[model samples]
Target: MKKTGITLCLLAMSVGLTSVVSAQTQLPNSDFEDIQSISGVADNGGQPYNYEYDSLGQGWISGNPVNRYLEIDHIFMKDTSFTHSGSHAIVMRTDSIGPVVAVGNAGLGEFVFNESNPFASIVFGAPFADRPHAFAGWYTYKSVGGVAPSDGDDRLINGDSLLILCYLTKWNSTLEKRDTVALASWTSSETVTDYTEFMIPFNYFSSDVPDSANVMFLSSSLGYVADFSERPFGVKGSTLVIDDIRMHYSGAGFDEYAELNGTAYTVGKKVVVRLEELPSDASVRIVDMAGRNLVSRQLSDKESTFELAYSGIAFVIVRSEKGTLTRKLYIH
Candidate 1:
């Protein structure tokens, strides 16, 4: 139930400009290793003038409202004990002070808070022009069964869910608005005790090149209702720990092979891949929308078919020494 109206504010300012990146790019501070303390107190009498707040490192932004009226800080915290790699990771938790439940969220862009109307608008996205095929990362989630808001989506009433999402956008001069070129989103309610890898493929909506990219992680997907009220939605204890986020780009060899010699299609609950001449070291992997690998095997023949046990949107990936190619599939 996150609001999309705030995206209109992005038109007022130009984000940091950078050279167009074409290769696979790992976001700055993707590992959450750089920890820094940002000291600030709420401006509208939310806290004492002497109070200070610790925030995330550079290249990441959060809507924790440390400078706002609520002044919630527990939404984002540094975690060294439960990390996937390196010495640090971030744990985003659904936090509440009194009846105000703030959903834990961190992204790549900046946020603007209007203390007058009490509206927090986020200008989400950083300058980038790459059309990466997939967004990959590692994370662990622990959900505390909480009731969804009365006006929220019914599907989330059972419990809170963690969300990871990325989108590519371009400002359309003709339309005078931002156009979403591609998007990849994943949400899960299951409790994961150990860190698990995830790769979500972007679904292209337009053929136009992108000028900005945004990636975000949220501890509770149904906590948006608390934005305008002091009433809580999701449980305060639900948490998500994440580390090592990266973007996946298609290699040249994979592109050439796909255009000339390979083809992939879905038939019912199965995926069929055909390569005129399969490489000896090539392999095929099938993953669901949640980035869970369902099938992986070496390519022994020019044409191979794999039966899928689950049905939904899936990705068919072929990997070899030449490169990696991915195809989107829809199985009914």
Candidate 2:
């Protein structure tokens, strides 16, 4: 069973910071209704095979490598047959493409496939900073086995489970590396014929604010089980259908809603934050609705004020060794 500790060095290297004028906590196109058609050619033995498939619209990416030198097997596709809401949902299937049998996987980021070096495949996360309480979604799965290996390996086993995972990350300037602020992961092997709701609460490991978030879905937890050549080995015909993915802010596991001995209010174009007693490591961060940090600084005094450039709603988050407090600031 592959866990979340896989080295994301390639993923971190692909991340580039971009300025956002505004932000939103909700993910874009979560319903999987919007889609784009992709066409490509793949190597079928020594001949070329042409194919096309539907990809997740925008704000989402899959590791499917079409138009490659090897036989193309689409791991992700749009499914209309089984959906919790709307007209479409996402379907992932484990498939065999020539010498490789890979599990379907998708993430909320950008993906770049390296043909010469599959291990060098890169996936960088999108900009997100909000710390939600839990990640919620709907999904259904069916597991199947029996696929022969081209390399004369053992037949694929049945009852492989699927995985849904999300993580919050922050860049540590002193350590010069990305650190995980929170993580939520869920996996199951039980077959579900109908769409079922699921929620996974985040486990925070740091008091610092995150700068990015990564959400991923996989048809099999053992998708990354590589053979001697580093090719993924998995059971074919395993399918997972998912839709209506969202983040929940107010819930039982939320730590950001904890009581704090502080007050925050908007004064003119600036937001004022005052704490009764400031801890030595206490810090304040002001972010827009889309989770973009407007101001982030350590508290040197009991009271501090930050000026805002834009109007509307923003969040004032104060974190310390004691706990975390979040307040809303409306600038008109």
Candidate 3:
């Protein structure tokens, strides 16, 4: 159905500003300076640097082997004396230390071991409530080969690529569990020599603000695909050094009327359309393909729920002095 005449004016809309968001929050131990044991130290030297660590302190979590791949586990994550800024920097590697090198390679995230799969679900995320414009960090990648099509850089693993994933999830009342509200991923080419600063931009999937989030940093992209049965095709000695990671947020200070998330809404269900203030002349109508009006109603209030008894295809029209907006919806 063609929208003939309409103007959807939202009068005096008001949107609340969360706050001034120029401040950037640095996550705990983001500098890779704090060192704690994810896996208890095998040997205690003395005090501060007494024991070796497979992981670090703070909320960071690392996946360490439980004796299956002990030889490869310790080398995967080493809190070495190497300093990007302070006493230590985190080093992750697909080292050639095990029977099958790079098989039990390491990555870090906020996760834990799963009961069904002892070594699975390795990294879990922490609660990150806000969305950042960019994720800024410093990292260096050193692998064997080039990141070219002809140069053994398959998406899976070859020269060994580094991956960092940041996810924002929320508990959905309908879904009954936490779900992903937004995500940002960073994949590095395997040919970086000096420590380079990186800025990863987020491509948000949903407009919904997130609840808890998870992050994953891996030295090799294909380390655990075979579940330690065999090594991945990535270079054995690939290494990633990282430090000084932080989240950057910027928000515009303003107020505006709430617009629909999209033009489409699922039919036969209560769909909430938000409005800060309703226009006095605002009107809504649903029409069939034959130009017959199915329902016509005056809209009021900051929130309105719409539902239709008719099934099949229809065009929902909202009109005010501003203009008309036609939305095609499939009713079931």
Candidate 4:
């Protein structure tokens, strides 16, 4: 009897391990391509929207550049940066309009938008007609040489010239300014040969602001600007370069799945489908192709697996804090 019991226990252990592996194959995971790029600029020279450009420095669909020499610069955002990722970033060319760069210049160093000049706010175009986009670049400025001049209200990372930094809100459609870590001064203790790095937060779009707003405006006060003067100063000719611009959702999407119980689970066999990986605090629901909700539960912990009976071609949908995921399981 002892020998028989030991054999059964070993068999059960093997079955459990196999069940885990199988179930993992059945659960769904998230992918990045599903999300769309809300706003950005590329290099191939196609219009993302309706707009006109002139050599005199004016994108006709929007407004005219005060300076004749300045035009919206072009670049190709790198794939490793923002383009293929999930969120947003906006850049500006800070040189076109100002007296030694003024702070009060309308839409000087930010994504400025309004009903009258919507085009002036977010101008859209493509560098290549075939490719999606090449770059989404902008410009800003910061005081250099520790000079807090009268017009220098805000200081940016690239001191003494155009500040080239990417703001997170411009990419994340769901986020606002208050939830981001504004760019502060770029500190480099080394010589000109030394490299300077900025520690940008992965989830800068999720940070809190002074108010609970969906559209938060970042200024020099919020790391977007540094201590140059009482107010943030705009440094002209300062260009913030962003290439391979992409957004990162961080929110999980549907991936894969597996079966945990029996190959032919009997009716009322207490069928439980274990998740291979859980993304966030998710809510689970078992449904049919016809969109009928058969089962629902919240996944607070890994122990929160799905329990159902054998049914034909059932789908398990997990809606978490990040996003929704779906997986198919068979029942007999």
Candidate 5:
């Protein structure tokens, strides 16, 4: 409780300091406020299958269930008359959570529903011109097994997980990819019964300002489970609700660690952070609660320790070719 509370407080205090350079263009219809149809009936093998309205035309794409594999979206995960912010929120559900097996995915850019190659369900990058620091949103999740789905010796335990992906790209038209600038992925199996805030902090892969971005949201992390030849997917009947998604330009900085000398500490103090398996080029920065950089260093070893200075609830943003990790640190 202390950890969660303290973190939330710091976030609230730092909101104004992390200035938004330019308003991140909201992913077209991100709030799920445009409800063309709350309920709809679709044809499935000439059978009447009931479904809710999805955000296909509202800047999202999914599989061609009629001709390809099965896919759908926005399963009334929001409260009956309540919304996270606007008039509504986006909902994603999987077949694992219910009697039906539906792939619930929505993302910026485009989705290629590959029938022959499920792995080919590649979501191409979208035109994005901003270099925001992170992706922010609120979400809630639910599942039956209460465990993340796992695949083992030819069997599945009906696991379900949520996936959020943000990739910075250079837009290579020849190979049909962003050329890879920076990327972040969040995959969790834990059931979140409440709407929780989340941020996808950007970690540059190549220092190049990405000309395009690709972001994805999924109710089922394992999209290939039904193929039966790939890794096992998670349980069915899982659902997720998302709302108020945004990308930010700045905030002085945020904290990611909360221990100094192995004891609870206040901000604006000093502490040491130890990380293992770091690449030689790994970049680590210590930022104040206002998102101000205080310390910066580059790692040249497999394992290293950083003595952070001037910290009271400071954030340690570590960037490597692999990915970025942010830990909260507290000092007294």
Candidate 6:
């Protein structure tokens, strides 16, 4: 008993020390707070979901709201079972989370049952003009009926499944049609036994969407396993637990620095400050630290090698037909 007590004390001390180090480093999740929550069906005619606080105090089992809400009794993994109607939607209140997703309901068809409600679904993690860089969670379907319905006999099965998506607010408020960005995909066969990690890049994102995306929706796309179709879909009779749905600002994907090829020019001769990759239709202006334009030249496709008798720290702003890229060089 004395040894166990010592071990516990040591562990607590270690945690304290680690916290101090993290505080100095300004790491993420330091002052993090769970800002927004969407679960267990608020009384405002909202979606139904279940919030399961795990033993580790880091997870929740919830349903996607829109269809049917269900409760599981601990037979499967994560949090027992999933409800389809709940549609497992939660809006995180992270300061640096992502370029968020939005919900739109513009041109949805008329609702036969509920005339006021045209459609019901949510979008997740679409970086429109406002937030062009986004990241989101992944889902995989694992029911018995093999994801697709044959004769429309209730496409969802009694097994296990997962749905993951984000809401881009390209549509109106009817909830019928909206644009979506699929970050990663997982089906029961792909993620169950061998699934570990997935990655999504920003260059592959579509840039034609608008900038009014602010809400996130996670609904079962009808009964389909992967809902890539831009129509209204529904999810019911299952549960999903989402954790670590975050965004990463990868520093502009490529090096913004202009490569100055020193080998192309001879050092013996005093040459002008020139660049080979300067755009043909660009205006190149070389300036000193005091904002004085020392040399100005109209560039072309060919490498421009000029004579620069002066040598110092200089700035080169190249305005090309494509865009403007700036760089600094030390002329020795």
RMSD of each: 9.0, 14.2, 17.2, 23.7, 14.0, 21.2
58-111 in candidate 2: lDDT tens per residue?
657666532223354454444457778887777777775554556677777665
What's the CA error at residue 229 for candidate 3, in Å? 10
Off by over 4 Å in 1: 1-19, 40-50, 65-73, 116-119, 146-157, 225-232, 251-332
Error of 1 at 31 (Å): 1.5
> Could you tell me the TM-score of candidate 5?
0.57
Clashing pairs in 1: none
- Give me the displacement of residue 55 in model 3, in angstroms: 3.4
For all candidates in order, the CA lDDT equals 0.65, 0.65, 0.50, 0.27, 0.52, 0.29
**Evaluation by lDDT, superior candidate among 2 and 4:** 2
Write one digit per residue (lDDT tens) for candidate 3, span 40-104: 33443563322233346665655432222234434223334444566666666665433333422
> Of models 5 and 6, which has the larger lDDT?
5
Cα miss at 198, model 1 (Å)? Answer: 1.2
Model 3: lDDT equals: 0.50
Cα error of candidate 6 at position 150, Å: 6.1
| lDDT per residue as tens, model 5, 79-145 | 5444578666667666532432455555554443445645344444455655777777888887545
Which pairs clash (backbone N, Cα, C closer than 3 Å) in model 2? 23-290, 24-290
lDDT of 4 by residue, 229-269 (tens): 32334333333322222222222331212222212122453
The candidate maximizing TM-score is 1
Residue-pair clashes per candidate: 0, 2, 11, 57, 37, 45
TM-score of each: 0.63, 0.62, 0.55, 0.25, 0.57, 0.30
